[model samples]
Target: MQAFRHFKRVVTDWFLCGMFLATFLAWLFPRFGSSGGSMHAEYVINIGVFLVFFLHGINLSSEQIRHGLKNWRLHLMVQGFTFVVFPLLWLLGKSVLGTQIPALLMLGFLYLCALPSTISSSVALTGSAGGNVPAAILNASLSSVLGIFITPWLVSLVVGSGSDGIDLGATLLDLCALLLMPLVLGQLLRPWLGRFFARHKRYTNVMDKLVILLLVYAAFCNSMVSGMWQQQGSAVLLMALVGSGLLLALILWMTTRTARALKFSPADEIAAVFCASKKSLAAGAPMAALIFGAHPGLGLILLPIMIYHPLQLIVCSIMAEHYANRPAPQAADPALVSAR
Candidate 1:
């Protein structure tokens, strides 16, 4: 039992293991996870998505957002990197190296790029590194909310005729109805429900992971039925993993340099790099379901972010520890100092 517990700890440390297991299960039994599968996975996934966003709204503290609003420069820098610089980098890579990458993977990269920084991971890492935790919380939350509107427009602008002829106007309406409405409703009821969610945050996290896994399983199940894996095979997946790592490294370098060049304080720099460099799989998965729902290549397009998510967590974790060990800055933000 002790050995089993240790093994479970090791496996759970990298959450992507669960996703890979889901993909493997999908491959083995595609019919169970396919859109019209025996399990009726579509209905389950839809409900799961709604609940995930609703929980997000309840957990997000308006007071924290208000407190974090004072650092305009840091916020501007972080948001710019997330929304502007990351997408620009992807576009440039596509222009120069487009032919080298599979078309679907390129699309995946774009979606990954346009996504907002993840909320929990970004703030957690910042706090761990003794960075501006409030700023991280605000910027990450803001990014997720903004991406609800901006990501679709950005993808529609460049995706042009690729996403099963997605009608941007229709897609936007669906997202607002599916994602935004639940979020707003939850936020409105936060006064009553917030404490319950706070106490059971672990359960909400389990729900979030299960939803993402279901999406992955359904996506791969559909792709398997269409024989997408046969066409692309392991080679494409290997490229995606390698490419994700390189892209993450480049972004990390850029964020660090840009933050230093702007002369941001150490804590702010830590927050900027972590918040700007990370992308949200939680946001990306549902948005993809809405935007590219009809596309046959949905699995391939979902590949990069799936690959990028674990890679960023692993890499940023090391970076966070390094930052944590660094000597205190001569002058630190009072908020950050207090956090430590």
Candidate 2:
């Protein structure tokens, strides 16, 4: 049991590496010889995303919601940074990249900006760093819920015309089906299932990993079927990677500075900065399917998130450690001090 716990922790913590390695293997093997099962990848990706959100719902606590409401300023900062500032940056990126970038790729970038702030990772990092875990949980959860509506609208406004055959109404319905419905269902049953989820935390972690792996395989398979890999050159791919890393770094720094400028508490600042800055591939994948439709080549567009997700984790992990080890500030709450 202990060994299994350790293994699960390693996998969850290093999920990006596992996802990249899985995609690499799938690409290397070339399942069914170059025709590419990218559609299959998309199917798996959507299902895995659904399951991920369901589990996310199960873990949410009403108590967290209450606390989050109390910390309205922190919540506002995080959500504002995520939905407002990030999208604006993507608009600037689009202007700069122009025709040098494919519309599909630009749409993918817009989708990245539209994604909700990450929940498990932000809270995990905050907790590990001795920051405000409850606030992190609330801010991240609210961000996901808000993103359901805000993301689609943003995509429609910015990338809709560029996309072929997109039905905004239908896509919104799908979003409701894929995300909002499950979230509401989970919240409704939370009172009954909460204890079970707590007790079977190990199983839940396994499920999380399994779903993500399946999603990656399906996304890659769809890309293969659509010849997404063949469509782009190595130079463009490398440029996309560099561009993605720089974008993430800029947002992280910007949000951190913004939080500090707002006079947020150290814990609130950490939570706001981390929660506001990061994007979730898990959440973004299904929305990509809805927005991009049969263009599995667009799945390749998600490659940046796959790369950025892990980098954020590693970088933030170190930052979390640094914060955790720092001397306690004078204004630190007695309750937080006790919790730490």
Q: After superposition, how far is residue 129 of candidate 2 from its true place, in Å?
A: 1.5
Worst 10 residues of 2 by lDDT: 30-39
**Mind giving the per-residue lDDT tens digits that candidate 2 earns over 13-91?**
6555677676876587545322235335545556766776777788788797787678888888888888999889988
Model 1 alpha-carbon miss at residue 322, Å = 0.8
Pull out the clashing pairs in model 1.
Answer: none
Report residue 219 deviation for candidate 2 (angstroms).
Answer: 2.2
RMSD of 2: 5.9
- Scored by CA lDDT, what does every candidate get? 0.87, 0.75
lDDT of 2: 0.75
User: Global CA lDDT of candidate 1, please?
Assistant: 0.87
Largest TM-score belongs to which candidate?
1
Q: What is the Cα-based lDDT of residue 18 in candidate 2? A: 77
